[model samples]
Every structure is written in structure tokens, then in C-alpha cells.
Target: MSDALDQLKRHLAPIIRLQQIDGLLSWDQQTMMPPKATTARAEQMAALESLVHELFTSEKTAVLLAKCESALADAAPDSDEVRLVRVTRRDYDKETKIPATLVEELARHQALSHEVWVRARRENNFSLFAPALEKMFALTRQKAEYLGYRHHPYDALIDLYEPGMTYADVVALFDSLKPALIALVKNISEAERQFDDSCLQGDFPVEKQHAFTQEIVQALGYDLTRGRQDPAPHPFCSGFSRDDVRITTRFDPHLLVKALFASLHEAGHAMYDQGTPEAYEATPLAGGTSLGVHESQSRFWENMVGRSYAFCKWILPHLQKVFPDPFAHLNALELYQAINRVQPSFIRVEADEVTYNLHILLRFELETQLLEGTLSVMDLPDAWNAKMQEYLGITPPNDTLGCLQDIHWAGGLIGYFPTYTIGNLLSAQLREAMLHDIPNLETLIEQGEFSSILQWLRQHIHVYGRKFLPQELVILATGKPLSADPYLTYLQTKFKELYAL
Candidate 1:
């Protein structure tokens, strides 16, 4: 039995490494690859990804998977051997459904589509990217069809990123959040006092911002030896393995909060990767359980801690030292208020906690509509503006700020938007649980101590990886099923006090 399990692990290790190599290529395409190399990179990505899928879905993999499953049939359900087989089986079944040719096509298009998005966004012309996007969606729809689903085709797509999550689940979650969110937005708008965020906006050098952000992420427990940070159009974290995680942040030369918070956000992800046990490397359990759980860590660090008053106090001195002209004389409460000010924003990444989920809600609806063919790609810009007006009460003046803002669709991430909201909800739930276990969590933040918090995440969330489903991991970490109550309460309490509503 042990030998069968060992063979399964050994067989899967090279496949995992190949997948990581594919990921590394993706990271390079986004960060370091030259614009002119798009064609070559696309071919490279297609070949590598097609090979990975073929290897993963091979007859040998199937035989090993079956052998391991049979051998571990009577093992404890939670044992690593059993969980590894379970996760591998789930992945194997999904991968084997689609043809290698389809995999190659999707990979090639994703790479080409990303370059189109970059150029289109820079030129503020959605038309330049529209055809590629349409094709990507077409391929994605074909993918969902191949994967099969009981209800909505979107369910099959969403499950790839968030296991067991359905379109109905997202709809119900957002439906429950709408009334509360609307009330909060309304109350904040009509409040007697409004926060002044001018302190965060001013002349700040990019070099200084880079240096300061590095310090902040490192202080947040991201191991610099094992990880590094870079700049990207869209900030993201990529982990090839636990020891070689990397993060990227977008910088705004005039705004201090952009890079600072983005770094903390990506670092939260990097720390999670680094915290996973060394034994899980090159296995299905190496990274996050789901994109939603992964987002929880990033949002938790970026908002709950980095935007908290205590964090303001701890980071202010560092801020002043790095860029004194703006932060030199600012008080902790003032810094906190500036960073946490509630308002509708054009960019989702720069949005405050109070208005962040609204952005996700808009994307969720648009993506689902596009997937269902109810919405045409050409009319997507107008549809996006309508949703923005309806949800956030603001309209982006250009495609760059509107439909072209996110790179998800270009990368064929049709059902990925809802996970951001899921992350927000789980972050608050985790915070609530963390406070119960570590009463002085805020105090620790004020003193620049994040060991306990990271340790808590490591034990309860990071270690399990894909061994558990997202819902199960949430319940295990927070002692509750996934819920919107904590997130709504967190936003309501924080913003009401901030605005004195």
C-alpha cells in the first residue's frame, strides 16, 4: 500500500514541476518578456502546457491514481496519503476531459490575448482587444462544455478555481450582501463627515516607494530570502514552489498607498506559500486550497491589518522616514482614515473595503453574462458602465478604466471574479476567529509583530493546501461555515465609526 502511494507521488512530482515551469513562463510573460516576443512566447506556452496536460492525463497516471486510491481506501480520510489521492483524482478527472489540442489552443490564445489586452488598455481601445477576448470566451465556453456541469456551464468553469462553488452560490452570496452594502454606501455618502485622503496623494518618488514597500512586506513576515518583488501592470503573486515565491505590485508615482498596500497584499500570498510545510512541495498540496482562500490571505493582510489604525501607527514612522514630506506630521488616526476612506473608485485594486465587493459584484455579473452569450463582447463596455453606475454609482470614462482594467478575461479566467468577494468574506471570518484566539492581535500589529498571525494561518489554513475544499478549510479555520455576516459587520462597524454616521 505504501509502495503504491510512493509510486503515485513519484509519478506526479515531475508533472507538478512541469506545471511550475509553465507558471514561471507566465510570470515572465507578464513581467520580463519583451513585447515583440509575444508570438514566440505563445508558442512556447502552448507546447509546454499541452505537454503537461498530456503527461498528467496519460494512461500511466491513471493506473497509478487507481492503484493509490484502492490502496488508501481504508486509510483515515484526513491522512495525507488519502487526501493526496483525492486531490489528484479530482484534477486527473478534470484534465482528462479536455483534449490536448484544446489545451494547446487555450494556452496559445491566453498568451496572445494578454498582449492584446496590454496594448488595448494602453491605447484605451477595447476594439483592439475585443476579437481576442471573444475568441478566448468561445474557447472557454467549449472548455466548460467538455468539463460538463449539472446546472450552469459557469459552474464547471468556477469549479476549476474554487472547488464545489457554483454560479448559484455566488448569486446567493451577492444577493445577501446587496442590501447591506447599499445601505452602507448610502450612509457613508450622506454622512456628516467625510474622510480626507489627500495625505496619501502627493509627490512621492517611485524609488522611495519601492524601497519602503519592500520593508513593509518583509516586516509582514514574507521571507525575502525565498521571495522577491517586482512591478507589473496588474499586481499579482506567483509561487512556483514554497521556496521560490515571487510577488509583483503596480506603482503610482504620485500616490504612496498604491505600492505600499499592493505589496502587502501580494506579500500576504507569498507568506502563505512560504508557510506551507516543505514536505508538500511539488504536490497538489503545495499552494493554496483555492483562489478564494488565497484571496482571503491577501485581503486579510492588505485591508484588515495594513489598513487598520494599529498598522497605521506601526508603519507611520517608517513612512515618515521614507517619504517625510507627506507622512512626516500625520497622526495614526489621520493615516488610517486616509487609507480607509470609503468612496466609489474606478480601479478595483485601489478600492476601499467599503466599496471593494461592489466592484467584484459588477465583474461577476458581466463575466457570467458573457459566458452565457446573453452579453456580446462588443457591447461589453456599455454593459460594464451600466453595472458600474448601478453598483458603484460611478462610470469609467475610458476602456482602460472600464472593461480593460482586469487581465482575468484575457487569461481565460471566466469564473474567477467571485473569489475576490469570497476572499473578503473569509478574511473577516478568519479575523474574528483570530481575535478570539489571540486577543491582542491588534496590539501585535501596532508593535510590528505578525509572527502569531502568520503562525495561526500556517496551522489552520496554509498547511492543508488543496488537501481540503475551500468550504471545509474555511470552517476548519474559523469554526463556522462560510458566511457574509462577519464581512458585513466588519464593514458596517468600521465605516460607520470612520464617517460618524
Candidate 2:
């Protein structure tokens, strides 16, 4: 069994490396790649993706997996060896069904689509990106067909990011959440806005924002020696290895909340990657378990901690030093209220915690329609605007703020939006569990000490990496199945006090 496991690991190593290389290419394209190099970069990414598919789906990998499974038949069901074999075999079976040509085509189309999206978003022209989007969707549909699903085509794609999650499960979850969310939004909208966020509206220099974000992330235990931060059109974190994680955040000169929370969000993701055990490096377990689980970390730090009163207290002194004019008269409690102000927003990334899930619900519905062929690429902007108005009582004037705000669709991430809402729910649940364990957590955050929080997460969540599925991890961490009660309760309690509702 040990020998077979070793052989399987050896075979999987190069595939992991190839994926890391692909991640680096994606990071470079999103951040530092020259505009003119889009074509070449797309070709390079396509070639690498094809190579990875070929390697992962090869006959040798199948043989090694079979050998390992047979050899480990008697091993404990939850042992690392058995878990690795199970995960690798599942991946190999899925990859083998899809043709490498289709994989390459999807990669190339996604790359070109992302570039078109960037330009279209900047120009506020969905027409300019429509053809690319159509192609990406067509390819995604084909890919889903090839992968096969029992219920819906979207199920196939959703499972790729979140294993064992089904379209039915998501729909059921959303159905349960919709009424509560609508009621909460209505209650907040009916109440007069209780906080003034005008304090956050000032000239915050990019360099200073970058430096201040760096300070906060470092304090949060994102090791600069192992990982680094950069600016991107959309904030994200990519890990080549546990030690080589990269995070990015975009700065808004007039809005302090944008970059500050984005930085913390990406840092949360990077810390999860950085905390993975070294023994799991270059293997299937080296990264996050799923997009939903990964988003839990980012949203956890971004909202539960970064937007909390304690966090504002801890960060207020630094903000005062960095932008004295803007923050001089603003105290910690005021800043917290400002950042947490419940207002409908066009950008999902910039939406406050109370209204954020509506943005995701809108996306999830639209994407489901797109995948189901009911929503055409040309009509997406109108559908998006209608949904925005329906959910948030405002309509975006253009596609840039309407349908082009997210990079997910451009990158062929069709079933990814629901994970943000899922993450939000999980974040609150985890916070409840954390508070139960550490009664003084808020005080610790107020003092700018995050080591205990980070360590708790490392022990409960990060150490396992992908060794456990998201459902299992959640149950283990929170002592219950994933539920929205904790999140809804948290939001209701916090906002009722804030708005005097």
C-alpha cells in the first residue's frame, strides 16, 4: 500500500506542478500581462491546459490509481492514503471523459473572453464582448455535457468547484433563504439610513492604501516572506504552493472600504493556502477544498472580522495616520457603522454584508438561465438590470455595473456565484463556533491580535486542506451541518441595533 501510494504521489506531482504553472499564468494575465500579449497568453494558457489535461487523464495515472486503490482496500476509510486515492480517482474519471481538445478550446476561449470582458467593462459595451461570452457559454455547455450529470447540466459544472453539491441542493437552499433576505432588505430600506459613510469619501492615495493594506495583512499573519500582494482589476488570491501564495486588491481613491476589505478578503484566502501542511504540497490536498469553502475564509475575514466594530477600533489609528484629513474626526464606532452601512450597490464586490447575497442570488439565477439557454448573451444586461431593480430597487445604467462587474463568467465560472452566499452563511456559522470557543475574540481583534483566530482556523479548517469535503469540514468545525440560521441571526441582531429597527 505504501509503495502504491508513493507511485501515485509521484505521478500526481507533475500534474500539480502544471496546474501551479497555469495558476501563475492566470495571475500574470490578470495583473501584469501587456494588453497586446493577450493572444499569445491565450495560446500559452491553452497549450498548458491541454498538457495538464493530457497528463492528468493519461493511462499511466489510471493504472497508478487502480494500483493504489487495490493496495489500500483494507486501509482505514478516512486515512490520508485512502482519501488521496479517492479524490484522485474521482478527478481522473471526470477528466478522462472530457476530450483534451475541448479542454484547450475552453481555456483559449476563456482567456480571450476575459480580455474582451476587460475592454467591454471599461467601455461599458456588452455588445463588444457578446460573441466571446456566447462562445464561452457554448463551450461550457459542451463541457458539461461531456462531464455528464444526473439532474441538470449546471450540476456538472457546480460539482467541479464544489464536490457533491447539486443544482437541486442550491435551489433548495436559495428557496429557503429568499423570503428572509427580501424581508431583511425591505426592513432596512424602510428605515432611514442611520449612518453617514461620507467620511469614507476622500482622496486615498493608491500607494498609501497599498502600504496600509500590507500592514493589516501582515498583522493578520499573511507572511510577506512567503506570499505577496499586488493590484488587480478584481481582487483574488492564487496559490502556486503553500509558501507561494499571491493576493491582489484594487484601490478606490474615493472609497476607503473597497481596497481595505478586499485586501483582508484576499488575505484570508492566502492565509488558508499558507497554512496547509507542507507534507500536502504539490498534491491534490495542497489547496482549498472548494470554491464555497475557500470563499468562507475570505468572507469570514472580510465581513465577520474586518467589518466588525473591534476591527474598526484596531484599524482606526492606522487610518488616521495614513489619511489624517479623512479619518481625523471619524472615531472607530463611526467608521464601523460607515463600513457596515446597508445600502444597495451596483458592484457585488462592494456590496455591504446585508445586501451582498442578493447580488449573488441575482447572478446565480442569471447564470442558471444562461446555462439553460433561456437567457442569451445579448439580453444579459437587461435581465441583469431587471433583477437588480427587483432585488435592490436600483438599476445599473450600463453593462459595466450591471452584468460585467464579475470576472467569473468571462473565466468560464458559470456555477460559482452561489458560493459567495454559501461562504457568507458558513462564515457566520464559523464565527459563532469561534466565539463559543474564544469568548474574548472581539477584544483580541480590537487589540490587533489575530494569531489566536488564525491558529483556531488553522487547526479546525486549514490543516485538513482538501482531505475532507466541505460538508464534512463544516460539520467538524461548527458542530453542525451548514445552515443559514447563524448568518441570518447574526445579520438581524447586528442591523436591528445599528438601524434601531
CA lDDT scores, all candidates in order = 0.92, 0.91
Global fold similarity of model 2 (TM-score):
0.99
Please give, for residues 169-268, the per-residue lDDT of candidate 2 as tens digits. 9998888788988898889879876777888899988998899999989999999999999999889999999989999999888886788889999999
Top candidate (lDDT): 1
C-alpha root-mean-square deviation, each candidate:
0.8, 0.9
Candidate 1 residues 1-501, lDDT tens each? 899988988988998999999999999999999999999999999999999999899999999989988888889999888998889999999999998999999999999999999999999999999999999999999999999999999899999999999999989999999889988999899988988888777788888888889988888889989988899989999999999999999889899788888898999899888988888998887899899999999999999999999999999998888788888889999998888888899999999888888899999989888999999999999999999999888999998999999999999988999999999999999999999999999999999999999999999998887789888888888988999999998998888888888
Model 2 lDDT, full chain set: 0.91
* Backbone clashes (count) for model 1: 0
Residue 81 shift from truth in candidate 1, angstroms: 0.2
